[model samples]
Target: MAITDIPEYAHLTDADIEALGQELDAIRRDVENDRGERDATYIRNSIRFQRGLELSGRALLFGSGNRKIWALGAGVLGVSKIVENMELGHNIMHGQWDWMNDPEVHSTGWEWDNTGPSAHWKHTHNYIHHKYTNVLGMDDDVGYGLIRVTRDQRWKPFYLGNIAYNTLLMLFFQYGVAVQHLELGRVAAGRHPNPDAFKQDLRDVGMKIGRQVGKDYVVYPALVGAVTRSRKTWLRAITATLAANTIRNIWTNAVIFCGHFPDGAEKFTRQDLEDESQAHWYLRQMLGSANFDSGKTLAFMSGNLSYQIEHHLFPDLPSNRYAEIAVRVRALCDKYDLPYTTGPFLLQYAKAWRTIAKLSLPNKYLKGTVDDAPETASELRFKTDPDQRLTATVDPATGRRTGLRTAIGKLRRRRSPVPAIAGQRQAKDVRAA
Candidate 1:
């Protein structure tokens, strides 16, 4: 059961949530007002760097007859693709630079180098995923309709291959993105409401995939082979391109998984969204996303997605500003005593993988209760008096706000016997507001 009562789960009252939302709104306005030539220049420079690196890789692959040169070319190309996909493509399509009014970089005009059609991706990603976020049964990205990442998803025998499915998904992530819009499972089960529309979408996906494959595998290899007049060189060029795409795919998968499926990235239920307010939505975004530690180079390579919480909160903001935005967002978290879910890159990714591995098993075999697991939790986990809504308050001793994070700590420290007598002692320890 995902969290149905977000305010209770967050230990926030209606006033606190609204005030938090106003602060977030102010942050958005500040960023929007601050967008200027500097931001535009940043995006332009990024485009040039990515395109230049890609061109250099292609030139190197022309002489890929040498194995070492082939590897270097592949590595460079892979990095370029990562920048294009993560930083440029993802951001641009999110309408981050729409204010620049540069048609070339506009969300409507720019088509990414991936196999997925930009139009289809915009709908699935920018709209559905961002709006629904971690709401169970709404966000297909929960497990990408494959591996079980949360206990809310029923464990079936098919999930036994969670690790295997994830490996394949990582290696060929672009293909997964390409087919995601089709909802093939529904079509296969004869549940699609409109077969004609599905067919059209499938055809669009096929064309995009075909173009990508031809450019990466056939056209480049043939051109290199014709120039070098060596069969080995042609084959090497194809392999190099394949290696590059694999690198991009694996890195993309890791960064995305780290931001999402890790511990502290909470899940919610549709009931939470019923008449949800702007402030509550902001709270949900904060609770349902995670971040990973990174410096400039690593952050740039990840498209600054290491600050995934900031990105989700202000998806349309310039990606270059996430670091600064994080500073303020963290301060707000501190002010409210909320959990700011973040960790070292490897640790975060490991947590995500760990969740996937553990969730493949039935709930009976798992250690944590459904209500209080690392990957799943509900308002019931707090064990507050149902008659009284607990609100965060300033600690008289420390003058610090004690809220969700503090409550979670208390819950974790409680012994097994504590719950048996929790009701008897609830009034003394758990204050009701």
Candidate 2:
């Protein structure tokens, strides 16, 4: 459903929206001023950890005659690759650490160890994806222009095979990301304005793929073969690299898919973007994001994008600060009666796959969908861990949330814009109507 069509929030005027935006901006300013040695130390120390893992993995790969050792090496190497892509590379390329003023760590000077060109990724991801965010049709990352994610998509018979196609895409996910700047869908649909420009972009992407393939499959493996002198050394080396890459690719696909496609995340129409105020934009960001209520391992693996809403609200803020920022964001949401979409890592991970499988069928057109979600009983209520990271649903009468809600009620009893009597009467009136 269209964003502006939501009558619930119509009570908030443009001035009220702007006031809410100022509160959010205050958080950004406070964080920006406070960033110092600790933030820099985190990034630098993380890079060392990643490099150490890669070196150890390659050293073990040289001795992969033992199947167990090879598996261990591949797992280690996969973690290295994951962190580089997830934490160090992706965040640096977002200009997150640029405030440190170290050229080596600067966005302009840093290049990632991936087939996807850093420049192109910044364009497609940092600029486009973050800017348009979850606005339907505008963001290319919406199913990467392939799988129909929402009911708004015009369906066809070909979508019947999307389950298979999405699986294949995950296996070769890096390759898909590498060529994303090419916008092949537009070219195929004859929407591209200049074929020559697109061809040049494709050629650049081709060179990137060649360099990546050679480094992983040929050069590294050959170095191992020379040291080991086993006839099967080159083969084992190549297999190990492939294994690591596959692990990294699968993880990247999973974490990203969970961020937006998981159960309660919402999407917006073009009209929503056009008429949006700063508060409206923030609201969209909150609705459009789904977070993982996971532990540290998945958090590091996702560059703390596990707090996807926080990332949307403050894209350039240090990721480590997301945990702290989440508390404030949630308080604000609760104050304004907004839904915070999140679940355990496993739950969101599975929900995203379920969304893909469900969308593979023709969208049943008999009923209206609201805010890009079906009118069925799939709405999620979030509950948080003690740290208040969204993980499950709060029963209205129990546990940590009950304590928090009691506090919230005490606070709101004084400041609530609407009277308690009117609120209940309104609810009853709607039911009677």
Candidate 3:
């Protein structure tokens, strides 16, 4: 077989795998031992959030500065807050700041700005989702928003138009920006609650939404357009608003879309939530999560999501630990006959684009009704292939469906395993026989 077309990766020499294993071992050690001072960049990230919040405070002051300048500053503050959300808020919420030992770590100031404590992200992402990895219906990581991430997603209005209506609601995107934490918190809890935390979350969300609308429509324009009648002044105000909003969109969406909506990922519901294996759950975190080859600095800056496998394996471990653990996670996958998924960051980014490109007026799959019944090659081809050759007929010699290779090949290229939509993370949770 041609080198490029090797049926199994084992075609490569054992030495290659061994070398990889050694490297991964080293990585795992480094990640586990990340008890040193906060890296310099992490400090900068903390400052970024603080600066945004500080500026927001100033804008709320309606201070003595030029109105245009204040508006511009407010605009910058808005984008900064969103940036803080992606870079800092998320990290704090994940308990990245646990080492700090300060209660404020979870507060908005530490930039761990959680909108709702009950959102399952705390439970789902940090606890169950990471623990379960990609189990169907059980882990929330595979679904983008409420809609399914896999091709077989049940299309329904709330689920399907999730992005559409959400986009419309967020046209200003600020609505999402303000309260993403609430939804995540809800998802993390996995069920409705009757607690003070949930009640507080409801109140906070209303206030934040009101604040977002005020910032975008009232506070922004009056402070920006009304005071700056000069053409150049008003134009700058508009430019600042657009720039800030654009930055906010790219910043928030990139990390999130990458985390859940990649090609090989799963979308589980209540049914798929059966008992899970530890190893299987870990593998899901590795496979379900994509690691873009963000440069070393950017990876750390991004809180290591570009190296998501490591993060899932060691959520309590700081992001700086990911670079060290990445190799070990890969090696672990190998030792257990699992796939270590990684790629050039941009290539993985295409998966996000494909997700958006495929976005439409929401379908049935979003409503959570995908039948787990075994699917036939014909059905697979109908969903994916235009050419019938994939399902033309089975080859008796191989005892495999005629189109098995083509269908599987498509999934494998996406670096996913058979039972394509299932979580690959279970490897970590399963006990050895």
Identify the candidate with maximal lDDT: 1
**Native-to-model Cα distance after best TM-score fit, residue 276 in candidate 2, in Å:** 2.8
lDDT tens digits by residue: candidate 1, 306-415: 99999999999999999999999999999998999999999999999999999889999998877889899888887754432357988799888888988877766564
Task: Give the least accurate 10-residue stretch of model 3, judged by summed lDDT.
Answer: 1-10
- Each model's C-alpha lDDT? 0.93, 0.77, 0.50
Candidate 2 C-alpha error for residue 148, in Å: 1.1
Tell me the spans in candidate 1 whose CA falls farther than 4 Å from its real position: 384-389, 396-399, 415-433
TM-score of each: 0.94, 0.84, 0.59
Q: Sorted by TM-score, highest first, which candidate order results?
A: 1, 2, 3
The candidate maximizing TM-score is 1
Which lDDT value does model 1 have at 146? 92
lDDT by residue for model 2 over 1-433, one digit each (tens)? 4344221222234554566588899989999999999999999999999999999999898988778988998999988999999998888888889999999789998778789888889999999998888677788987788887776667788777778888888888888889889998788899999999888888888888899999898899999889889758668888989999999989888889889888657666676776667777776677678899967777888999999999988988988889999999888766544567788888898888877777776667433343324311111111112333222234556432222233224334545657977888999999999
Give the range where candidate 2 is weakest over 10 consecutive residues by summed lDDT.
375-384
lDDT of 3: 0.50
Q: Provide the lowest-lDDT 10-residue window in model 1.
A: 382-391
